[model samples]
Target chain A: MSRVRLSFTPAPVHVRTARLVGVAVARRAGVAEELLDEVRLAIGEACARAVALHRQYGLTELVLVEMSDGPTYTVRVIDRAPIEAGLGLAALPPDELADEALTDEALTVGVGFALLAGFVEDLQVRPVDEGVGTEVRMAWPVGR
Target chain B: MDLSLTTRAIGEHTVLEVGGEVDVYTAPRLRERLVELIDGGARRIIVDLGRVDFLDSTGLGVLVGALKRLRPVNGSFGLICDKEPLLKIFRITALDQVFPIYATLEAAISADSSGSGSGE
Candidate 1:
């Protein structure tokens, strides 16, 4: 297995850079062309969410990305900003998860977990290190 | 990558040609341009995405926001996107139902000008 890690400031400009790096690493891992688009979008959204969270919480730490490549490509975007209260996926009731609740304004305002969930093969969002921040874990098969 | 937008007036319709990547880094610029056009009384707008190399959820959000902004004034917003990668994004998000997407700029402009647009 091959592993790569990248670190970036919580800035909008770095989101694109992180995405490019993820795509490059995925390409080298033999991820197919059609799957590259999904990789690109998923990583971009993950970085964008990280940046927005840092800005919202007035945090000053870097966003870290870890990638592992083998039969499956796995990416973990770690943000040093806590998930906002009541916004955690586990915190919301089942009824609130409906598509009607995701307004354009809401989606634009940093509620992109749904988009990430839709694009990746697997997704896990959880607090990291005694609730200091959030980690977004995403993975997809290499050939898919 | 940076985004470039150029505007042209086609009779009653306004066309905005977009080029380059439209991700989180560049989507804000597109959103601002669309807001400016809407604020300036542009009721019929066509966004040509033929030159756009990439688009993500952030870009889709801006397009949806623009469509919502036009709804209050009975404005129409249409997209010209033929590329499969871009079209696939819309399809994945089910946004193809929200915006009137055409395969070409001429088709979008003609349809909008003829009052047979889908944004209504």
Candidate 2:
């Protein structure tokens, strides 16, 4: 397996840097053109979300992106911004929350996890460093 | 990558041609331009994304915000994008139905001329 890693400050400008590096690495790994498009969008959203989270919490830790190539392509975006209790797990009643309300909230809440889930084959969100921060892990089959 | 925006008036509609990446960093620049155009009495706008290399949710959020801003005045907003990557994100977020997307700049401008520019 081949691996690539990048570290950058939790700044908006650096999000594009991470996305470019991720796409370059995926291209070098022989990822298909159709898949590369998805990969690029995925990385951009992940990095953008990380930057927004760090800015929201006033955290200074660097956002780290790690990519691995093998039978599958995997990428992990890590941030040090603390995940609040019951965050991203609330199950809102469809009757109570209007679609417009949800869309408005999504603007400030970072990239929608549902969107990411639709793009990648496998996606997992978990607290890292003893629940002090969050890690977004996503992977896709290499030949797909 | 950096973003560059150039604007021109197409009849009563304003066309903003964007080039380069529109991620979190460059989205604010686009947002500012959109705000300026709208606040400057631009009632109809067409954003040509043919030259845009990238767009994330941050960029989409800006577009959505612009749409909302124009709604109060019955203004119109449209997008010209044929790129699959950009289209995919719009589909994933169900925003494809929210904004009228066209294959070319001329089509987008004319779309509003037909009195079908009001956003859903």
Candidate 3:
């Protein structure tokens, strides 16, 4: 199995760079040509969300991305922002709560996940096991 | 890499041409430009995204915010995006039904001339 990992400062400017690197890695991993756009977009949204969370929480840690090529090409984006006890367990439906009442930053973050759901077919959002924050895991089929 | 925004007046409408990627990093610039136009008394606006290579949800949020800003004054807002990849993003988000999207700049401007901003 081949794996690639990227870590970058949590910043909006770095989100685009992460997307580019993720797509290049995906292409090298045999992700289909037609699906590259989706891969690129999903990576951007994931990285952007991580950046927003880090900024909102005033955390300066690096955002983490891990990509592995196997039966499926998997990408996992991790943010170091603190999460409420049960917030991560609920799969971040903050979309519904986003409608009731939310700060502008929260709404912006919420919309990113909504877009991720639309772009990634196989997706999972969960709390980190060892530390604070959320992990957005997405998988796409690959051809060897 | 960088976003390029330029505006030109065409008849009673203002066409803002956008080029390059529109993601979280670049979307703020887009939002700022839209605010400037609205504040500068631009009522009917069409964003030409024909040159845009990439657009993310943050960019869509900026466009949606612009529409909201223009609605109170009965201003018209439309987009010109002929590229299939960008159009697919709109379709995936169901925003294709929300925004006035045209295939060409001429079509958007002509639609404005007909007293309707409904795009193609």
Among all candidates shown, the one with the greatest lDDT? 3
Count the clashes in each prediction: 0, 0, 0
Q: What TM-score would chain A of each candidate receive against the reference chain A?
A: 0.81, 0.81, 0.84
DockQ of 3: 0.39
Worst 10 residues of 3 chain A by lDDT: A89-98
lDDT per residue (tens digit) for residues A5-71 in model 2 = 9999888878777888998988877788778877887787777778877887788889989999998
DockQ of each: 0.38, 0.39, 0.39
In candidate 2, which residue ranges exceed 4 Å CA deviation?
A85-105, A108-111, A129-131
lDDT of candidate 2 at residue A86, scale 0 to 100: 15
- Compared with the true structure, all predictions reach lDDT values of 0.80, 0.78, 0.82
Query: Candidate 1 chain B: worst 10 consecutive residues by lDDT?
Result: B89-98
lDDT of 3 by residue, B1-120 (tens): 589999999988999999999989999999999999999999999999989989987887788778777877888999999899998877766667667899988888888778778332
Q: What is the DockQ of candidate 1?
A: 0.38
**Candidates 1 and 3: which is better by TM-score?**
3
Task: Indicate whether candidate 1 or candidate 2 has the larger lDDT.
Answer: 1
State model 3's lDDT: 0.82
Tens-digit lDDT track for model 1 on B1-120?
A: 479999999888899999999888888899999999999999999999999988876787788788778877998899999999888767655677667899988899888778778474
